[model samples]
Target: MNIRFLAQSEYFNGLHLKDDIVLEKEYEQGPFTNLPKVRYFLYYLEENIRKEVMPYTDKVDIFNITDCQSESDYLYFIEYVDMLDRTYTFNIIRYNITDHTHTKIISLKDNLKLYPDNKQIKIFILDDSNLIIQRALPKVSENGKLKEFFDFSLILFNFVKNKQIIIEDENLTRNGIEFILPYSDNNCIMKTGYSLFQNNRHANLTKEEAAVESLFVVNISQFISDLQLEQPNLVMNAIDQSYYDTTVINAKLIENFLIYSKFNYENNDENIIFYDIETKEIYTCINKTTTGEYLLKNATVIEDTPYMIMKNSTGTQFFNLISNEIDATYPVEYNVRFVNNNTVISTIVEKNIFGKETEVVCIHKFPIKKVILQEKGEYIGCVTSDKETSYIFLK
Candidate 1:
């Protein structure tokens, strides 16, 4: 097997594969302006050539390009900080790849009344017309005591029609909707955290001591549908506690199942739980580990077979979502970075005799009977992987 090296850089942030071309972004802070400066380049692996693409030279505090549902158009944001009020403001810019034109969609200047003190912003692009923005900040108590509570607000904006709906939940102390992703082509599921004043699972703790972090799944398709219809203040009524437990902390929607980790606080161990959305039943894989946490990823094998990667302290486990079984496992020393139908790529960090650390790549061919090849370099992550070719970025 041949491992191809595309490009190496010092300011490498991320890499993406779109069709036959590879997109690379190098990010750095402007020395004078203190604003973020980004350089985008495209790599043609067949000819071993690289060309600089977009050069965003504008002076902005925080500039970002986000991909939405549209293939022809993308969304970018320009943020600035107000020193007098100590607040942040931003504008969303729509860039068309076909025409290369810029259009401002949502401006915080116009909606200052609605979004006044947005400390941290997270934007979610649902489709071509729908977008969700989450504004969150820590909620300070009356006596200025540091607490775990937070203030969260959601903005459902329809840029095409130039309409928006705002919803705020002030007392979302239980982590406040930590993650959101597409559940299906038309639906979305939110992994929300909440604290019940009582130990609902185990009644061994007092009320104040029962403030443990738990997770629940909420289907927000209705909110999306209502936002598209120009409805304001749409309610979220699909939160079901039967689908989760206190043991589950983090989750991700993979195909039809909500894959998450169920951690036992007392034993300090964790396991994988697959909750079927359709059947409302959960299948637990009892491979316990002392890692106490895990990262879940959705991966595809050759011929577009679905699989999930459960990374724990021991190693990475390749779980076959179709048959509900773990097919393979890699050691903890070898951090599995990417997986595809034909090959699995991992990175290993080693220290030299001088005590300096370096990362190298290990390539395993499917069904991974043995390590077919090993390449030495700073293999940070994979840009793209397929049946034949794989692209990775180096430090």
Candidate 2:
């Protein structure tokens, strides 16, 4: 592993949280409070400049990019709307960085008649053709007052032709679905959460259970067929659940290898299971105080040997994906991002000459992994506000 200081790299400036930060800007007083809009506080490497793409208008109370990500040279932005009718709308915005001259907005409300009551929808874009979207479980009150939604719909959209399929599990109204591993070439894994999870074998146990983690392998082509044909039953394989730890909070799939973890947010401890999809073999996963969200990634594949980044209480380590073993450990308060075959990016905070802590973005040249080789090219970097899904490769 090698590190090179990327003085040319840009850092994130974050979102607009408060209104009074800029005293010169005036606003018309309104009775309703809206979620904070993107004030376009971003960092540029070449020159110091601020650019706002979608500015707030008179008719719009809030315009938020709930999520955005990059695939190849294109960027996809998910914009959410909060309406007065207690209905929600989603607009998919597509932008091309290579051309920069084209932008497209596809509104869900215009295509589909269904309107989600909850604006907080989770989405995962699998490819150019497929999208996995889930509606969250409504929060239950102390008195068990349940809110009404049309149904708990998990939609799989083949967005190319505006074709979509919805899978709703009515018996588990209180449960929420999350995207897990990619099961096959055309399928991925989905898990249930947000409430008590009852394992099938322990169904008769009159006591509480861990977060209900139901694993399902959903076929893409069959799912769309069922929905388009107006079939009554959805065709999906429901995998048997076992009492491993608690629930699978997050997962990452690499080819036939899958890392499933049951992460407890409060205590910072997680139980992991490594399952091989092709062989149907399960490996007991070990973690040294791994605490956080889905930060697990393919560390740096060397040659044909694959490796991944796993975490502990102190820092991270490079674990072999095939052998299921740890190799090296990285220190605390730093994150490693595999930009591509040409470059690797990591963020580290260092104390400057002014005795102030400063974030320094380090860039590493690739071909570090001899295992899987890719064509190398000249790469440029840009930073976006949404760290969770945002990627900037502006040619």
Q: Which candidate ranks first by lDDT, i.e. highest?
A: 1
TM-score for candidate 1, please give it: 0.63
> Could you give candidate 2's per-residue lDDT for residues 279-374 as a string of tens digits?
766654444565344334443334434455666786656666677677555565655544433344555667768997655455534323222322
Top model by TM-score, which number? 1
Compared with the true structure, all predictions reach lDDT values of: 0.55, 0.45
Looking at model 1, how many pairs of residues clash?
Answer: 1
Q: What's model 2's overall lDDT? A: 0.45
Error of 1 at 9 (Å): 4.3
- Model 1, range 144-242, lDDT digits (tens) per residue? 433332566667788889888764443233345555655554555664554331223233333343333433444445556655554433355433332
Candidate 1 collision pairs: 302-341
Alpha carbon deviation, residue 88, candidate 2 (Å)? 10
